[model samples]
Target: MKICVLNGSPKGNESVTMQYVRFLERANPGHTFTTENIGQRIAAIEAKEEEFKKVIAAIESADAILFATPVYFLLVPAQFKRFIELLFSHNAGSAFFGKYAASITTSIHFFDHTANEYLHAVAEDLGMRWTGSFMAKMDDLLIEMHQEELVRFGQDFLTTAQQHPAIRRTYLPITSTRPDYKSAGIPMPLDCGDKQVLILTDAAPGSNLEKMTMRLASSFGKAASLVPIDDAKMNGGCLGCCRCAFDNTCVYTDGFSEFWKETVLPADIIIFAGTVKDRYLSAEFKQVFDRSFFMGHIPAFAGKQVGFLIEGPVAQCATLQEILRAYPSLQGANLAGVVSDEDGIAMAVDELIDSLAARCLRLSKSGYVAPGGFPAVAGHKIFRDDIWAEMRAFFRADHAYYTKHGLYDFPQSDLRQRLSTTFLSLLLSIPSVRESAQKEMKKHMIEPFEKVFSESPVLKRQKKEG
Candidate 1:
């Protein structure tokens, strides 16, 4: 059986994810694997019609399609994303219909689920028999256990492909019609004194996206500046070179670093405006995100408020919505809200503007940041552990930042907690003591909170004053 491998890594053959593919090929001599470096040669593929047709031809001939990529910014790299866009633009979906499909990605276990979810949805949308996904850690091939797992995964994939098993659709077809939106005029202005608000977009001139962004800014009444993503002097998408990991400097001398630091980073509230292209934002919008990889895994927009102004059927695209929500949360920014033209453009714009203004003001005043949920919490821990263990020597800047911010909150470092656990364990070794402790565990947990409420109003007031 011939399998088409869409390698979605800017590093091409050098990608760590491809090593797993090679292992699978060697382990299964019966199957033939043909690899296309789609992400690395996206520009050539887009520019040359023949090059693009070669990819479609490969898919048409293959018995199965394996999407192998490294998770970048919670999804595939911008280069790979562009290739996906080309499939839609070129009307080549028919080539992939009925093919057995699955995705494989390598990441630091940072939002890998979201990336896999995206690929699964994409395959289903293309009318493929979506089997499943194999998400590997970057170094999974090095471990004996993981090696066995990879072999099993490959065998399972081959079996599923040969049998041609029917699979349920994971995503509903997007049938939402594009609404004709006309601005109902901006509402009364709010006085956001000394607050820097930016409307960043990749919308073309005279596009509905531009109108939505303008209306949102008008609602703010502060004459916020619009920063077109195309105006940024970005050279290309991240190469996964890890050069920035050492000194926090990218290989390219593009002025994007200065623009990000001097303009984007300083904004108190940022409104991202874009039209949903294919299943995600535009390639230009993706470039803005992909280029930000120079900042490494740190939260570059911490404490900032962000809102989305989308001119598309966003409600129908659950994966894109998840990406939107997860992006801000992972960066330690509050997701003010996502407003879409599908919700009756005028009404949605007005409500979104009002919500953005209110949330920004409240957050700015209180300086309160909601704790990150599972994605950010887990992502931070993964990066923290990776940096402290293997990456410390290369990622010196991350090490310094982590040390300064006390991000190395290793659980074993708490001597009091460790000692208390040891004492409790020793006591609980006896059946009688264990029974007594189990009975009182609930009450013991409530004791700390009870003490807080037990304080007198006078004492509480004095503590507040102090």
Candidate 2:
């Protein structure tokens, strides 16, 4: 198989992650692997628009992609994030479909899960088949830098790559699903014919974060413009207090708002790049993120798309989700996509971006359509015929039904328990459940399974599916 190994370390071939790449190459001599360094080079090309054409061509030829980086704050390096933004500019988002992808990260003490999740999400969003993650903590690997573990990681990648088949077996078509739409053709006030995408990243030119951003962008986009954000004066921190409730502006009024107004608002999309600390967004990144909230209630993000490139360990993504869900400025915005370091980040970000992109595209092509009244899931075939059929069986009041389904051991008051299960699942997915209500509901879920199964025929079927 022909594989494209996108090395996202600014250190280039000198990066420790390269050792793993070497191991993979040695273990699977039968497979072909090509490596590229995006790093500061992307930012250089951003200044020369014509060079991007060649970069995009190379990416389209690759069969599978390997996103290898060193974790920074539980996310990909900032430059790699910038590359993604540039890829969007070239409209390379569609090029990722059906391709096999894997993420390998090296971090000293972090879990590298967030980085994996974010990268996987990017792949999934592009309709790619994400195999899995290969994470190695430098500190942990120091104890087992033996040939066996390195060989195992390489073999695992090779085995997984062999399992799933590629959608475009060879040679990607020049045009995407929406051929009329070009990366350079994003909607703008003025017409810019075939104008390559120009993106500025909040990454240092020589850093690992920057390398990851450029590598991803080059792999996925037409041409990229990467400008590093290296202003020491721009560094700041978020004050935990939610003082923006009154004036809708941050009270601490540092240089953060200026960064957004000066750097972010002017672009077609804003890509925030940073690392994670203590399972949360970096102080500097969070400070800017919080300060950007000054556009509150005025619909600053009504049509904007915000993307994030974070580097950290295990919990970076959870922290990112919590921040996004609670951020006021992003209320009406579309979250384009987040590339993290683990499978979970990819899953969550994919769902969020797909939903956001679908709705935004629908609205762009057609006007908003809202039901005259509240909509319910009761009659939806996806929920009723598929989901409810299983739910109903568990809540049925017939003890015989429970026994047939192997749920006879369920406790008393099973009807209430079955009903509560649906609610709990919904609460877990939907973030609106109150702690007090959840606690009270848990107390009422203890019940006999047989009695519950007999009470509802609908629940009986649901139990079977469960």
Candidate 3:
């Protein structure tokens, strides 16, 4: 069986993700694997029609298509994303029809699920038989057990592809019509006050996206600033070169870094506007994010109130909605609101946009950023640990920032908690103490937090205690 591997890493064959591809290739001798450096050569592929056709020809001839990529900003690299866009735009999707598809990605296990979910959906949308996925932590191949598991996974994929097994779609087709939205003029206009409100969009002219973004900007009044990233003369998608890792300095001499610090980073409230292309936001929007990787794992939008003005089936795309929400959440920012023009009623969409703008302004004024949810919480820990260890050598700036900001709040450093835990463990080892502790464990669990329910005001208590 011939397998066409779509390599989505910006570093091409040299990427760590492709090493996994090499593992599979070496493990499976009978099956031939042909690799295309999609992310590396995306520019040429998009510019030259013949290059794209060559790639399509490979896909058409292959029995299976393997999507191997690194999770960049919770999805595939912007370049790989553009390849998907090109595939759909140039009517080359038919090449993938009826082919078996599977994906393998290498990341720090940071939001890998979302990335794989995106790939799985894309393959399904391309009329491919979505088979299985293998997620390898950056160094999983080094472990003996993991190495064995990887071989097993590789064999299973070929077996599955050859068997012609029935496949079921995981995602339903999105059916939404963009409403003709008109600003109803906010009943109670919000005063952005001293907040630096920034509305960023990749809205196409005469499109519903433009209308939605315009409505949002109008709701925020003159104090707000709207910038169309689509018009920005961006050099290109991020090249996975780790030059930025050393000190947050990108190799590109373009105005992108200046755009980040001067425009995006200074905003107190940022409203992202876009039209969903396919399963997610436009590749241009994704490029903004991927390029922003120059900032490393820092919280660029910390304490900001972030909102979204989308002109797509946001309600239907649960994963996209989650990705949008998680982005703000992970950045130490509050998800003020997400307004999509999913409803056919123009009035309904207008009201939603107005409400979102009002909420964003109100949150910004109060300086009230909601507590980070699971995405942020888990992501913080992931970044913290990696910055202190694996990423420290590459991202020295992150290491310095984490140390200075106390982001490396490792549990091992909590001497008091460690002592208490050790003492409790010893006590619990005794039969009598263990029995007593087990009986009261449930009651003790809530004892510390019970004051919040009974106390006059926990907020005041916290401040007073401090």
Using lDDT as the measure, the top candidate is 3
Per-model CA lDDT versus the true structure? 0.86, 0.52, 0.88
- Candidate 3 TM-score, true structure as reference: 0.95
| TM-score, predicted candidate 1 vs. hidden true structure | 0.95
Error of model 2, residue 214, in angstroms = 33
- Per-candidate TM-scores read 0.95, 0.40, 0.95
Instruction: Give residue 453's lDDT in candidate 2 (0 to 100).
Output: 57
Global Cα RMSD, each model: 2.3, 19.6, 2.4
Expressed as tens digits, the lDDT of each residue in 178-286 for candidate 1 is 6666677766766777888888898777777877777777766764778888778787888889888887898878888778888788898888999888778987788
Candidate 3 off by > 4 Å: 185-188, 450-466
Clashes in predicted model 2: 66
Question: What does candidate 3's lDDT look like per residue over 310-429, in tens digits?
Answer: 888888776788899899988889999988877867788888888898888888887888788888899999999877878798899888888888899999999999999999899889
Backbone clashes per model, in order? Answer: 0, 66, 0
Model 2 lDDT tens row, 351-416:
433343333334433333222121111112222232223434432332233335443332444788
What does candidate 2 score on TM? Answer: 0.40
lDDT of 1: 0.86
